[model samples]
Target: MKSIIFIETTKSGSSREAIKTADRLGFYTVLFTERPNFMAKREEFPDVHFMKLCDLSDMNVLQKEVKALILKGIEVSAIVSYVDPHSYTACTLADHFNLNHFSTEGMKNIQNKIQSRELLKNSSVTPEYWTVVTKAECKELEPKIKNKFPLVMKSPKSTGSKDVYKVGNLIEYRKRYNTLSTLYENQPILIEEYLPEPQYLVEVVVHKGKVHIMAIIKQDIQYNRRFIVMGYKLLLNPGVRFSNGLMKAIKEIVAKHGLETGPCHLELRRKGNQWKLIEINARISGAGMNNMIKAAYGINLVEEMLKMALGNDPDLTPKFQKNVYMQYVTVEKKGTLEKVTGKRKALASQGVVEVYVKPRKGSVITPPLSMGHRYAYVTAVGNTAIEAEANAKKAAAEIQFWIKESPKEKITTVIQ
Candidate 1:
């Protein structure tokens, strides 16, 4: 039997869901991760093969390790990944095996914001961007920085808006730059034109060079010091005028990037008539959003990813069973996660499928600098966008992140 290789699963029980899908489709799972301590006993992972690597980030070493296994006559069917760190590995290994996959180099262009902007320099979608690697570079770029006042600063390679900030002037710029410099210690910092919000997340699945619009997610974003993605409401009928135009632009953009197969999650914003590009990730959205997509559209993006991985066709044809669905969640200020309130109330609400508050009592909480820090998640569905959003909102409002204060000195996070 052929084996499906996962560089690392994003979450437990096979991160990609591709693993389970592939397993059900008659394929074995080969997991390569740095966590040798995890499931130390072979019996703990039934029908799953595990391999240890000194460093999953060392591409050469990981490739060599896998090549050694291949040399031993192990038959593998496909390569798939869910997280960012291992995405390149999946692309590289798939390319090595001559499997249908996107370009690894193409992924690099977008992963590095500086390179991504360079690629789009001549395109209409390009934004004015510069890299500040040194303090001296910061001083030198002040003129252009001031010209494009209210600039957005971010790490060249980052997600969940970790160090992303908006600065109106030089002082604010210096403060953000210094904070980031202190955090990253000389890593490349990106400064781009601050695009207006009312942001949209487009989930696109590409197979055999064909692009499919799976779902256009609407996000309620809060950018007060921290870029917070509060929740999302799936727009079932984005309308022909919107869909046709957006799809055309996306198809052109994907073709421009030379993205081949698999899932690509795009962050978009429309300023007036123009659909501005925020960032494009060559993987599925993080934080179980795939489940939300399935709940709304009756399409499993992960399953599509699996099909594409195994050289099979995906059913992109829409089976739009329902109009709206949502996944609502929240993060908390610095404190210990005490008790959760209104969970039962939320669960009992109509159209609310489930409620989950991740942190247990005494679990410390911090500013949501990344997706993992999110406190809870609620999945809801309804016939209309308003109803779905209301259900999600009510459920979210019902649950509270009751936190007890921790010593301010104990918090070493910069977000504070």
Candidate 2:
């Protein structure tokens, strides 16, 4: 039987769903992960035929294990990963096995923000950006960009809004620069012009150099210390002309980067009638994106991506159309979760199709520092975008978290 090898996957969401999808499609599922104990205990992945524990960060170990699997007569059909950190590794392994996959170089470019910005520097999509690699470079570049306040600083390896910051002035720039530089010492730091609100997520699938637009979802972002995407609303009827323009730009980006096949999602913002690209990932959007897409259009993006990885034609045709909204639930303060309430209420609310909460009674929780901080979400469908968003918000509001706040630090005075 043909087998599919999956790299490290998250505890939930589309990555985990992909494993289940492959099993349902009659493929022998093999998982390579570092956290076998965590995954082995989960009843969600009972169909996973084999689970191998190894250090995923080391490519040599992964290659050796794959070779061992082949020696054991495991028919490795395709190697794939849904997580960001291991995407390039999975693509490289796919090439070694002569499997159908995206360009490894393209995947690397997608993984590294600096390289991606350099590749698209001349394009109309990217923002004005600068890179700093050393302390001297940081100091030298500061004077040049001092006037360019409200710039966004990012570590090249940052993902999911982590290590990404918006600095409003020279002081804030210095502070954020110090923090990120210290955290990612010796790595290049990306500083770009901050793109304001009304962000959009464009999901694209490319097959043998042909680009297909799957969906365009408008994002509703909320700001605390970091920019948090509070909700996503699928645009069922984004004007034909507008979509055409987006498609053209996306095609250009894909062609320029040599991304001939597989899935990629682009984060974009409309600036004065022109769409500017924020970032692009060589994978589908994470979290409840697959669920939202399936709920709205009756298409399983994860399954489609898995089919593409296995050298099969993906069906992007929509079975139905409906406005869908996904609202993320977040906390306001740092604390130990004491109790959660109203999940039943949220699930029973009108138009709510799904409600998911992550934290348990004893789980520690905090305010949004990144996308990972979002503890729960509510997905709803309606006749229109407004109604969909309203329903999701109403349902999400019904779910509440009760927590025991962390104790404040005490200040001590030293007499001289």
Candidate 3:
């Protein structure tokens, strides 16, 4: 029998769900996670294996040890990484093993924000205005860019909404830029015209150059400094034309950019009757959004991505059971955890599937308004979209979080 090696850094939903998929795929799953305390849910399963990976970025060392493992009777057929940064190493390792995989060179186009914008703009999938910021360069290009109120400034290589900020005028822009420069130490930033409207998330799965629209997810986002997605629901019934002129445009762009395999998650917004592409991700969306799609639609995209990596034909079915929502219980603000109630009651409610809590009593939690700070998430599924939304909202409201005067930082992670 073959084996699957999952490459992950942190123990987020992606890490846990990767293990679950490995079990479903009937392969001996080996989890390579970052150093000490890589929460191995091995106790929940008898077949899966977990290994602490010290440094996955060191490709030369990793390749040598991986080759040795294969020689020592470990049948690792595919390497998988859902996280974007680790994707580079995953693709390189797969290439070294002569395994089917996405190109590391192509990953270069996705990891760097500037490159991705250029690619999208060239294909006409991007908005009209975009600028790159450096401590030495932003001032020179300021005059060229239209100083529209509520402009967005963000790190070129960031996920979630950690360093994303919206500024109204020059004073606010300079202040925010100074703060970020002090904190991030001169990382290149992206400045763009903000599109104020409802955002739609499109997840597409590809196998052997065939693209399948996996799900149309409606995002519920919170505006702190920038847009941070709190939760989402799979909109089975879309009023908007999903497969019209817009889809054809995106398909051509993806093909032109040579993103022929794997799963692609993109964010778009409808502004005054026109759809605009925001950004595209070469990997799975963070926060187990793909798993929610799997629960609603019978398409196991994680499994499909794995199958594609193994050079096997994937089952891309259009079968979908409507009315399901995936919600992540998020931290609202920085505070000391004093109370958490009604969890038991909410779990007992209909359509409430799972609850995963990271912070306990006395654990200081940061509100998820920013990508840098999110406590935990709650996921629920229902019979209809209304039922699903209602159930999730009920659960969210029922659970109360009491804060203390002074809170400490306990959980540290990116919003994604």
Best-performing candidate as measured by lDDT: 2
Q: What is the lDDT of residue 104 in candidate 3?
A: 64
How much is the lDDT of residue 35 in candidate 3?
50
Clashing pairs in 1: none
TM-score for candidate 3, residues paired by index: 0.88
The estimated TM-scores of all candidates read 0.88, 0.94, 0.88
Off by over 4 Å in 3: 39-48, 183-186, 381-383, 404-416
- Per-residue CA lDDT of candidate 3, range 1-416, in tens? 57877777345565456667777768877766665454545364444564645577788877776776688798988887887677767877888888746756666666667877777775455676556457556666566654576788877766777777887887777777786777767566677778888888888776556667778788888786667676787888675565564466567656755776777777888766456777777787766665576668767677677777777777878576857776566555577788676678767877876555556798777666564355545567777788887776676555656667533422222233
lDDT head-to-head 2 vs 3, winner: 2
Total clashes, candidate 1? 0
Candidate maximizing TM-score: 2
Model 2 alpha-carbon drift over 4 Å, by segment = 36-44, 406-416
lDDT of candidate 2 over 332-382, digit per residue (tens): 777888788889999999899888888888888887899888999999998
Tell me the RMSD of model 3 versus the true structure: 4.0
RMSD per candidate (Å) reads: 4.1, 5.3, 4.0
- Please tell me which model should have the higher lDDT, number 1 or number 2: 2
Error of 2 at 397 (Å): 0.9
Model 3: worst 10 consecutive residues (lDDT sum): 406-415
Candidate 1, which segments miss by more than 4 Å at Cα? 12-16, 35-53, 67-73, 338-345, 404-416
